[model samples]
Target chain A: MSILLHDDTRVIVQGITGKIGSVQTKWMLQYGTKIVGGVTPGKGGQVVEGLPVFNYVEDAVKETGANASVFFVPAAFVLDAFFETIDAGIDFIVIVPEHIPVHDVMKMRDYADEKGITALGPTTPGILVPGKGKMGIMPASLFAPGRVGIISRSGTLSYEFAGILSEKQIGQSTVVGMGADPVVLCNLPKILAMFENDPDTDAVIIVGEVGGEQEEKAAEFIAGHMKKPVAAYIAGRFSPQGKKMGHAGAIVRGSAGTYEGKTGALREAGVTVLESPIHVHAWAEKYRLR
Target chain B: MRLHEYEGMDIFEKFGIPVPERGVAGTVDETLNIAEKTGYPAILKSQVLVGGRGLAGGIRPVQTPEECRTTAEALLETEIKGLPVREIMVCKKAVIERELYLGITIDGYSGRPVVVVSTEGGVHIEETARTSPDKIASFKIDPKFGFYPYQAVALLRRAGLDGKPLNACADILVRLYKVFRQYEAMIAEINPLAVLADGGLMAVDAVLEIDDSAMFRVKKMLSLSPEGRIGNRLERKGKEIGVTYVDLDGDIGLISSGAGLGMASMDIIGHGMEPANFLETGGGITADLLYKCMDLILMKPLRAVFINIYGGINPIHEGAKGIVRYIKDHGVTLPIVAKALGNHQEETWEILKSGGIHVVTEAATEKAVERLAALLNTSSPMSRS
Candidate 1:
């Protein structure tokens, strides 16, 4: 009923021996995700959290039929790990590393596109299908099964939005964090298209920020092709010019990436853009009433 | 990180891209010595990161040693666009037949590295791309195949470059792409890829911006300027401890989780008091790191401190522990407002209260900002307890 992930999605954890990978694997397992196996390059033929470990993704896939992958590799090794995953035919991937070099991201995006694989992020918090399956590092307690599909560029903002929706008794069908990088693989348009096809998803909430033209492109897509109700909240409205506000991608360069431009574009596309993150509940309610 | 023009040129020179003979001078004597070796008609350009240096009189052409010395002296003493010139690059001016632009940048729209070239060059390529889009020709480089020799030639040819100039320009474009990839650069630009009267091409100006996150891999490139730190002292200290902090012109010191939330918190401030700083303690930040972040932000002269956190990977408990430890250690009496949600929210709030610190329980940023405004107004005249 959700987009990208479901109950039958057998996931494999890459870099499973790393501290973050181990911890998140436990969390995902506790949430009832079908973690079939793990892959740590050096530490093969081992057991981590009751799952078999292999050296390469291909080995893990051949042994366990692992079709999905969640990478916890460091930024330096993300490129190599990404190529391996793509080569192994893991159609679904969620990269958890941040600060990956832009050149590597370009290559990864290109290779993923050519091979018809779904790559989530090089700096993302991962994706979640409420009460079905979870991949990546999102805290599962804040989300509940609902009809609203959430997509965000910020990890913590995604958690905050999900928390707000959960508090208002509104839940999400799926929530995807597109990472905080300037160039991400699964952008708003791609995820918007998926949400449009999910039958359980009644409305979509897009959490975007200043910097990059992804939001404007999403606005254009929604204007022309979408049949689902969409509401968005673009952050960094009062951010100072030329200062990089934490995220490497969250910057305003000239007139290209600005809050005013993104908000105006979304509003013109007949989408209700909120001024605050907590207002997603109100929009969801409006959609529900309609 | 944006490299100074001289530094970028040094990389270009290393990669076999032709550039004018140049030397950096910090004094009048140094300028004269460089001018003597570079010959008369030397160009004195100020070394500053910001643009519009040409319009700000940061650049001057000196034909005599006396003019060079005086120009260097003036530039060294002068501030162009609020950035004082600490060094001036003296180079032999080129006999230009035409000016063309060549640059390689990651196109955000396409998610690919694009090579942009224009026959009409050096007068702001962004403006040229906006006004007459046809004047600029761009080719998105496929990362798997890279910028091939044929692709570079085709790109230059499309820009109306032909014959010897086209070959020379194409060679420079290929080398520039090498420099871009080798150094992990975000932008490798030569504004005026000057074509000499003898039909020779040289990069008269260079701009290279490397990815800051790639600093771990590109050590030698960063070592070119060991003291070239990006921000003020507070901001630099924040960087050392994994926190991103930017000082602002306000009195309320603010710390938040995500960059978007940090900005949203600043925007939500209702009172006249502006945010003194923007600090983001990234995901999985430890208590010790959070304590360090609080210590750094508290160092600034502020009316109050607001801590807004929405934890995902960074648990709320760690942030709470950091705040409590800071309050207990410093015995700070300044009005502190905190709002935490997600992962261990209840326990985090309880810990903050136990440490005798008032926590803002509102989930909305505006409500928290309102609470801080109310606290600041009511506590302005009250003595520290």
Candidate 2:
């Protein structure tokens, strides 16, 4: 019932031989994710955590029919790693690497769009479908089985939002950290559309910050098509202007990227706007509380 | 990520786009020599990584070597639109029989790179778009096929460019598109593709912006000057803050991840709260840099400072070390509250173990909002002093 990921989705680790990759593989496997295979070019035929390692994504895909990739590649090798997944016809990719060059991001986006693949992040926390399968470094203890579907631009913010929802006994069907850098266009509106269409998700919690018109655009889309109750909190609402705080793309250019503009857009679209993060649960309940 | 006109034209020439014989001159003598070599009737343009140079008196036409000499001398030491004029470009000026504008840039609203063509040349295209939208023909290039020669030719023909000019414009357009993709440029523009009386195309003015993230690959892209494109008061404040500050026509100033948080902060301001500038301090936020950030925020005429952190590995303490050090060195002169989470909670707490600073502990971002709202009400003693 969740979007993009399910319990049956077989996962392959791209940098399985690395320290972080090995650790995360064990965590993901412990969470019941189907760790089908691993890839570490020169370390092919090696085994980590009892999982077989292959030299290439194609080899892994061919042997295990693994179509999803969780990449723990470093920034320098991220582009090549992504192409490997793309070449193997893997439709789903979650890139854990940060600080990838923006040009490579553009190339990745273009390539992904051309292939109609669903790729998340150059700085993402990966994707998670609660109680089913998980990829990324999100705290596992914070999640529970619930009807809320969450999407955010920050990994820490996602963790915070999940903890808030969990405190109210509100579990998430899926929590996707859409990354902040080389941010591919898995935007809020698109995620909202997916959440609205998903039978398991009853409500959607969207976390956004300043920079660009993505939030404003999401507000427009929410106004027109989002049938499910939507709650939003745009952080950095009180931030100063012209100083780059975080994320390369999180900039307010001209009249386009501002907190007021985004909030107004969301409010105009009938979205339950929570001015701060503390009010998310209350706002959600106000819209659909029992 | 934005390149000046000379830099863009360099890529244009590399890609075989027919650009005028030009050289960037950092001195008045060099400018005169370049103009002398290019013959009389040369153009001397100030090199700044921004638009609207003509309006800023950065672009000038020189009919004689004396004019070139004087203009270069005057401009080389001057500053335009906050960007210092380090060099002036001297190029062979074409006898423009006809003027046209052609460029390819990313249409952020559409999430695609677009080819923009206009019948009017050498003027601000924004004015043209406002006065007569139909005069400018735009096409959203499919990133897959991109801008092929035929597609570009068809687009130019639609814009009313005909005969050899149309074909030449098409060839230039294709090359420009290739340059855009090859350099991973955010923008590539030629203000006036002059139709020389001799039946040739000359790119009179050019500009390009390479994605900053791609700077690692573009080895030659050097930091030309410390003060660049300080567009406004806020930008000046950002300079005071000593961070990379790009002012938007908005009210909210953001502090987020280097790229993502910076962008998200702006969208929040633009879409949710008030409008503001976009600022990022992600990869290299040291203790000194934090002071600069604080100083920048405090100096600006802003309602509040929004601080958002998704600490990768630095932990809360490292961030706190920066903020606390900034506060101790410069003083908490402004109403600032931040939410920093992940990685090193204990270390972050250790750094923030101060009575003066307040850290929002709740996972719900609402805690941050309430704290900011409260801080906004209490006036800092520094404002009075």
Over A1-290, each residue of candidate 2 has an lDDT whose tens digit, in order, gives 89888767888998999977897788788777888989998999999999999998998999999989988887778888888799898998998777677657766777787788888886787877778878877656567778888888777677777777777777889999887752464656677788989999888888777766778888889889988888887766555454221111221133457778888888899888775555676675665632
lDDT of 1 by residue, A199-222 (tens): 988889898888788899899999
- Real interface contacts reproduced by model 1, as a fraction: 0.41
TM per candidate: 0.92, 0.79
Q: For candidate 1, what is the lDDT? A: 0.81
Candidate 2 residue B62 Cα shift, in angstroms, is 4.2
Docking category for candidate 2?
A: acceptable
Q: Write the per-residue lDDT of candidate 1 for residues B1-385, one digit (tens) a residue.
A: 7788899898899999999998998789998999899988899999887666776788899989888877888888987655568888999888999888888877776788778888888755557666776677788887767777788889887878778788778888999999889898888888788999998889988888888878788866554754533566787798889888887888888989878778767666623558888998877577888789889988878898888887566777977888889889988888888888766878999988877766876556666666777876642211111
How many clashing residue pairs are found in candidate 1? Answer: 0
TM-score of chain A of 1: 0.95
How many pairs of residues collide in each model? 0, 81
